[model samples]
Target chain A: MDSFVLPSFISPNSEDIKRRIYARIRSDLHRIEAEIDRNINSSIPLISVVARHIMGSGGKRLRPLLMILSSRLCGYTGDRDVSLSVVFEFIHAASLLHDDVVDHAEFRRNQPAANTIWGNPGVVLVGDFLYSKSFLMTVGYNNIRILEVLSSATTKMAEGEVLQMVHSDNLEVDEEEYLEVITRKTAVLISAACQVGAIFGGASPEEEEALRAYGHHLGIAFQLVDDTLDYTGDVKELGKPVGNDIREGKATLPLIYTIKKAKPSVKKRLGEIFCAEEILPENFLEVREMVMRSGGIEYTLHSAIEHVQKAKESLDIFPAHPTKETLVEIADYVLCRRV
Target chain B: MDSFVLPSFISPNSEDIKRRIYARIRSDLHRIEAEIDRNINSSIPLISVVARHIMGSGGKRLRPLLMILSSRLCGYTGDRDVSLSVVFEFIHAASLLHDDVVDHAEFRRNQPAANTIWGNPGVVLVGDFLYSKSFLMTVGYNNIRILEVLSSATTKMAEGEVLQMVHSDNLEVDEEEYLEVITRKTAVLISAACQVGAIFGGASPEEEEALRAYGHHLGIAFQLVDDTLDYTGDVKELGKPVGNDIREGKATLPLIYTIKKAKPSVKKRLGEIFCAEEILPENFLEVREMVMRSGGIEYTLHSAIEHVQKAKESLDIFPAHPTKETLVEIADYVLCRRV
Candidate 1:
């Protein structure tokens, strides 16, 4: 796995791109998986059980990969990157645990949510444990700069969550507001992961900022793709039901765009659908068709593609290397992947 | 307030002791209060509203006071202590927010819980916000030791919560298990507050350890008194209903002690009461009377007194400064406070 070779050219197909990327990063991913497992061990059995139920359920390890790849690109050769990479995954998993409970989600990654399995109290506490553990692990690095980046990221993430909650079910959500929510909720942490990795790798200030920007753009693209999948992807492929965002009354970019371009009659119908006691399949299909007709899906994907371009362009400061190529490929994969 | 003098001797009455301590720490408490308010300000109006709803309600601010007093005892004469002390208060408030949601609590501090008024989602998000904000503030200090102490305390606190949840409603929970739970849940954070203060104050290793031990014993005594109050306190005085611990299926020290000593018939009745779907007031009264008859209340209070004694003894290394005297008074007040 350590001697794995990357394809010379980019693959257009999502599956092939993902397989190639996974093969190239397989060793790093395995170490990240093991580190995540080791870090979550607790004296209390329930914490470990709940943490594993969510974390072990086939996450893509995207954030950790970004951290590792960023470090490698910045010329890091130390063993600590693997352990430090786990910090991002822990923070990500912790947020997901809390999100599932807050959303009253029934399923996550094709399994019953941890909160549903263990009840909310245990799940909530385990989420807290993971969060604290992440910070504690960072402290072991003894880097104040890294701590600042990670802590600030968490603060923004929490505020982003509250912003999303406040806007849930409200039809007046605009593109700027939606971007603000996603930027704080998803992009900041990813950016932090890259920035911390850059610091660990002894990157110059310019190189660190470049990686931060790259992560930010990639994170936004990733979320935009995710939101688009809610309208376009198959449930089996995505590991979650389509139209879930709409079902939860979350006004993602696609919906926001569709509402802007929608005629008053169609807008009234969408308002009715969203305001209903429950959104039915027919209503979802009707909204989906309207969104397609309004070019909302294409607009969202186009925006994501633009962000991916920016993410790749941000790597211009670094000399061409296998790690940099892999990062660019990963950015492309984020845009193309079905899940 | 700076010129206020401590009482020459200890007061047996709780109110007198509390009055003297408050008078001595009144300025520090005011600064902490203002800092807490300033730190909670958020761009999202709802976040600020929900944070203020719970935080503006009456709180003893014991954790922050301990930190401030410990710093003072260690000869800290810096302005940052006021802001740093807010970190402990924020963490304490964050835990309370999540706890109320987990416990499905209707009232906190004689008012509707933040969860009840704002719904669990907003409350939970705000809790996360506070938790993240607390860590973010600690990062500004650029003190890795302080950050390490806080992160570890939070991790233990979360584990303690899960441990308590696992044991909830179980009839077989023993003294050792209960002590473990309280130590992590309550004592760890208090001890961290003191230790962080000591670190900031440039205390010697012996002085720092002394304060840490002082806080641990004081925290245990504080929780013991709180548990006893649940069985014997007035609703008006405690700011919540009595017997809440048992109602929530918590086996606190009083109930655990009572179970160990109760006769077979009484034990069976207690089990039946605990198992009931709804414990009527009559059931609570019967259990309270039984706990009293079995000397559970006295036993718990006696144990608290012992801890209080140890807590005072932990401070013997420090010279008898006014701040030291205030800390002693606060420890005594913990044993005597009704709420």
Candidate 2:
């Protein structure tokens, strides 16, 4: 029995939420792990090595879990779900590999980024390999709808990443623009995972829309909490350094909210720190303090909680089932997870 | 009335081959260009900018032309061929964009590589966008076999790139290994283009296989000639530096063959030059001279010509139509093209 660690704000009863969800989905998670390992096998040793480094690292498998649970909720009893669920994970990992190169990131998931180890060229190619592999697997399914969802989602994800790059280090980025970027970059793929799962499960149109909505809100909430944790979470728990967004000049929700609410002097200081060639450690701390003082963290959390509620509400159409229950719990876990 | 320049060895009758092929496919090429522009239209301005920077450059459009021509040869008169043909170009351009970053290439088609203009991050993301867009467009076709061929080809292309990266700067790469690399990195996509075109044209299985064979050999021949041109062609005509392969330490067939046949003294010098941190201009020239003297250029060109014969022979089953004749001529021009 693994110990369940709860965030301070969560009720004590919610501590077992992780345990319950994991217990219910343990078999599915194992299948997903096996499928990922099997699918990522390649003739090129570097591709397999880099792919394993990122995919086998301590990823929560949140996207694949959403996919599997959504499929099950829609009454998909076929064995294909297990294999297909890995597609989302592969796409997610591919984007991360590319993101590592794009951001020149040093660490990811508590270890050196694959680009640092394998070099950017190999990493980029491996990411392409994983992407092509995902599509190849989807092609085997012979379901055009699933391909449509996955491909469009990936297109949006790329556009989102480019949008984020365009907005990087620009203090003028507003809340709407930030939301658009996050929606395309982070939420679209998660939503696609659920929607594709629903499609594979032969879901009704309404049910598919519900699951899609559930994933959309949950993805936003997940990213909002992630942004908040970047400032507030422990480096050890987060498995990456705190204040990375500020360091990288990414204008996430917390920073956008803080900038919106900051006083004139604080806003000026924030502008200076963000615009400077290098952000000093003291400046990072000052920005974090300002964000917290201005209720940016609380505001982001509040927004996340709202989205989580909407996500759960989106699942109301599905009747009582262990899969749906676990999915609901997963939504709450999105907010409570430290990493 | 563009004048055609023939390589010194080509008969004067073949000088008109390029003009004849272009005159035959001019409308199809125009349609392909327009379709590409339409398909590549993106909401993200940076994507459009970077994509145009590469796609609008003086690319020969060889892959798309093969697809269009192959489809025509198969007797498909539908409008979809024009749109579908652009898919090949989009995928090719996407790979090149990523390759620019991967190779740190300074020039492509006589202009600065897109990475140098927009930076690597944007280039990588735009490449991702183009890839996704290509997949999304293919999904609209509702053809599983086409998807299978393309997805598998892209998978191999990525593997090929990683294999090439693994072999980069390694002097021990032999002829067979070089062939494997080029087949995956270059031939696979081109083969896929022709195969997909045949599929779209509703070719019989034998005819489909023949076109696939045609494309496979033509792609190999195309790459072989490219490798030879790297050693022998004028830099301005090539639109990139001469000896780039050697400078990048890429062991193409010419280099590999030279290494195999060189005397011990020349072999020792070749090793020293290839192993050096940076290849000097004089070292590049010396290596080129050695390749020529050892008949490396001749051997590679001879091999390319053999493949071109095979490519042309693959179309023997088809009745002599303008499209088939042009494809044959295109095979001849592949050997004769200096760029």
* Residue lDDT tens for model 2, B272-295: 999899998889888988988888
Model 1 chain A poorest ten-residue lDDT run: A1-10
Separate DockQ for every predicted complex = 0.80, 0.90
Clash tally, candidates in order: 0, 0
Interface RMSD of every predicted model, in angstroms? 0.7, 0.5
Per-residue lDDT of model 1, residues B246-295, tens digit only: 89999999999999998899999999999899999989989988988888
Per-residue accuracy of model 2 over A36-87 as CA lDDT, tens digit each: 8898788788888989998999788889888988998999987888888899
Residue range A1-339, candidate 1, lDDT tens digits = 011112233244878888888889999988988888888777778888888898899998888889999999999987789889999999999999999988999898889988888888877888889899999999999999999999999999999999999899999999999999999999999999999989999999999999999999999999998888888887886777788898898989988999999889999999999978899888888998888788887888888889999999999999989999999999999877777
Question: Candidate 2 chain A, which ten residues in sequence have the lowest lDDT sum?
Answer: A1-10
Q: Tell me the deviation in Å of residue A326 in model 2.
A: 0.7
Q: Report how far off residue A226 is in candidate 1 (Å).
A: 0.5
RMSD of 2: 2.9
lDDT of each: 0.89, 0.88
